[model samples]
Target: MKDSENAVDIKLIFQFFMCCLVAIVFLSSTYLEFSDYAQFQHKLKNKNWVQKTMEITPQMEIEIFHYRNHQSKIIFKENQQEIFSKSCNGQLELICKYIENHEIQIISLNFYTFLDKNTNNYNEFLLNTIAFKDKQGQLQTFPYMTDAPNSPQYIAEIKTEFRSFFIFAFLKHLIFAIMFLGFNLSFNVFKKSTIKLINNLIITTFSLSFISFVIRYFLL
Candidate 1:
């Protein structure tokens, strides 16, 4: 009888642990999603530009279909047919407009194509993103760039901001305060331990801030 009771207790503990794990995963995922939304909102409020990255493939053929004086126009061909023409304004920073999802979007792209000597086909294409103004008159550059797909340094300014102790500490404190306020308002069970939680959060904030400073100072 005692053995059966012990086994039941262990099983209950295991189930509780699994429940906590699942809750942590759900909460963390939700937090990340909301944080990303908040970041986008902040960018929009600051009139920053959001752009998408694009890559060229060998399937697309390129031709210098038009030239006049100093300006030139290049056309893209796929399957022996011309698809779209990009016009350069005497420079490489050409505005390429394309329809995406039934909406017209503009991107500044510099296109280059090389013919394959062996295959006698234009199999090489290079594309570079250019700094340009968006429809809202916001200057888009590599530093304030967002939506750079697969880029390692996406919005790297955030990391650069963290290098400043004031910004890092302030942001950490703000995040913890928000989390504490949220828990205090939403969960009744957290009421009694509110003071304890606040103290712990304060300690954690300082500890993390100091660690960040130390690591950046010594290692980075």
Candidate 2:
């Protein structure tokens, strides 16, 4: 019986080591992907023109497309206090009227495909946030930009949700399903004296993972 127990303990230790290796790979890959995404976002927000508009005839519906169908649409607001365009609609009205919240049909994105083309784009990154006023005159950009070490929200229209394409925000929350077990096992290994340390590790991991997902889903 003693030999059998010893064998089981050895197997468990091996499994734990394997898990650590896997976790290291996962976290490292996540960081690298995040770095690439940050660069793409920065290019988008640092273009020459922050915003522009195509003059639409009054009361016409405008179908806006950018970077190959990063899309949204709105009807032109007739007789409204228009800017730039012959008639205003879409993000323009929503922004000018001070519909300052994210109640409008706008997606604050953090990640984008930076094709080596399109130097004519009228957008740019001011302090990590992509600042562009869309056709509807709405202030466009991702809500939260962390490309810089200590970036803050530059505009007021978007709520600064800090979405990225990592999917950790949406999918990784379910990881708590199994993470707590890992937590418990780690705690038992230290004979309960390092319980706090284990818990902190878990919390930090989950928080980082959550932020990663937010950036992945919204930005990338």
Candidate 3:
């Protein structure tokens, strides 16, 4: 068999190294993001919060994406009613009746759904008259969160819009690709460059991406 190394050039070797780097960087970063993502998902597996706002339908699966000031994204999946009430049980039939004929504001339903692609609607609905189970197992409605004792421990709940979790995931892959290409090119620059470089921008970019990718993947 003929030795293939004879056909290899300076650029090829450099790029091979770069590819290795990219593999490392992307792999580690993806791992971290996936780790955090899994934790958020764990909550939805089985848990319960309180009923604060509108009644969500048991049939509907509510996909919840939540974040606070500079926090990683958390995605919650559960029944719509539970997600809305923050109880996140499988069903919240008892909560909806109370919200129908009540006057209130600043509730616990931090549930958000987009009206359209461009708009996010957060129904901050609270009611005075809520329904609960009566002595005879019938629906008993009464007000909630009004005198629930606003304390420092009770963090305020708010809702906001978010992009698909995959968007961040896609972005992460793109970053890895750039690193792969750049690291491959950087090692070849100012020498028998493995990466073709007739310009400076291409050279600089390739170098950084290359170094970063390599270090993150191989060394880091």
Q: Which candidate comes out best when scored by lDDT?
A: 1
Better of 1 and 2 by TM-score: 2
Model 3 per-residue lDDT tens digits across residues 81-191? 333324322233333322323322112232212122234443323233434444455654444344221222222221011124345555665665566555545443345
TM-score to true structure, per model? 0.28, 0.38, 0.26
Report the lDDT of model 1 for residue 62.
50
lDDT of 2 at 49: 26
Best by TM-score: 2
**Tens-place lDDT digits, model 1, residues 1-220:** 9798777667666765665565456545544644564454344334323333443356765565444575566566778787556564433324322121222233344433444457876532334354445656665642322334223364354445444644544555455545444444443344557757765775676467446545643332
The reply for model 3, stretches above 4 Å from the true place, is 1-8, 48-164, 174-220
Model 1 spans > 4 angstroms off = 50-220
Greater TM-score among 1 and 3 belongs to 1
Off by over 4 Å in 2: 47-166, 169-189, 212-220
Q: How far is candidate 2 from the true structure (C-alpha RMSD, Å)?
A: 12.7
Alpha-carbon local distance difference test for all models? 0.48, 0.45, 0.40
Query: Model 1: clashing residue pairs?
Result: none
